[model samples]
Target: MLTETRRVARIVLLDPDDRVLLLNGFEPRNPATTWWFTPGGGLEGEESREEAALRELAEETGITDVALGPVLWTRVCSFPFDGRRWDQDEWYFLARTTQTATDQRGLTELERRSVAGLRWWTSAELSATRETVYPTRLAELVRTLLDEGPPHVPLVLAPEIV
Candidate 1:
């Protein structure tokens, strides 16, 4: 399969209670297998990663009144979805919002097909879930972020294949 390289911006969106919001989704080819991930997507046009982060948050989760924060991590990954091979460079940023309700009004048709829905999860929940999560050890990373705050520099995470 031909691989498409994409630059993606992801957010670790948290609520006042320190719970992180995750998107539940599965590859179109394999709906029986689903995974949870943060809210974000590929950059469009000339928009920077920051702009993409904010836009994706609203589009994917419908929470716009957010305080977008620093880039917490960066990762490179290869995954197959929607019948295409993708090589993605992802940046994970920190963001906060009080509104937990999500509106799918902004999701693209493709998104609607592949993305199941959004749910806010506490660190403990993240830790307990047997489902797959991207960026690996997400619960541990989130725990570190919450306990010690964002790193002085964005950490480069090991590549992932999904």
Candidate 2:
């Protein structure tokens, strides 16, 4: 028997002043409170992780010509969604963009409706905002990357459900 594979490639795009681009995402099928995360999505067909990252950035944020580099971090986890357990291996790459995104046409009506707001914020801002989840860690990561450049960190995975 063969098991299915689920791979997600995402980019953490940091601007010159050092603000990582994060998007508020939600599962429309089984609605939940919106949560903020880096902007990228799962790979489709035979698309490489790098290609998926670039494609997702352009599709979701209307930005192109991004310079993507090595994997910054990787996480393997599982989530319960749509009445099933979805195992996921998420890869994050170091990416940069000099231009500001203008058009957000890639979002669906429901996604647009669900997105409460959008703001480019610094690490301090991220820490201060009550709306941000995992505030402490997120702020620290942003600050680390901003100060010392990207760290090719690999998250350790324990064999257990998340």
- Tell me the tens digit of each residue's lDDT in model 2 across 57-88: 87778878678877877776566544567676
Q: Model 1, range 79-119, lDDT digits (tens) per residue? A: 87888778999999999888988897899988888889888
The superposed Cα distance between candidate 1 and the true structure at residue 159, in angstroms, equals 0.7
Top-lDDT candidate index: 1
Which candidate comes out best when scored by TM-score?
Answer: 1
Q: In model 1, what are the clashing residue pairs, if there are any?
A: none
lDDT (Cα, 0-100) at 11 in candidate 1: 97
lDDT scores of the candidates, listed in order: 0.91, 0.69
Weakest lDDT window of 10 consecutive positions for candidate 1: 1-10
Model 1: residue 139 alpha-carbon error in angstroms: 0.4
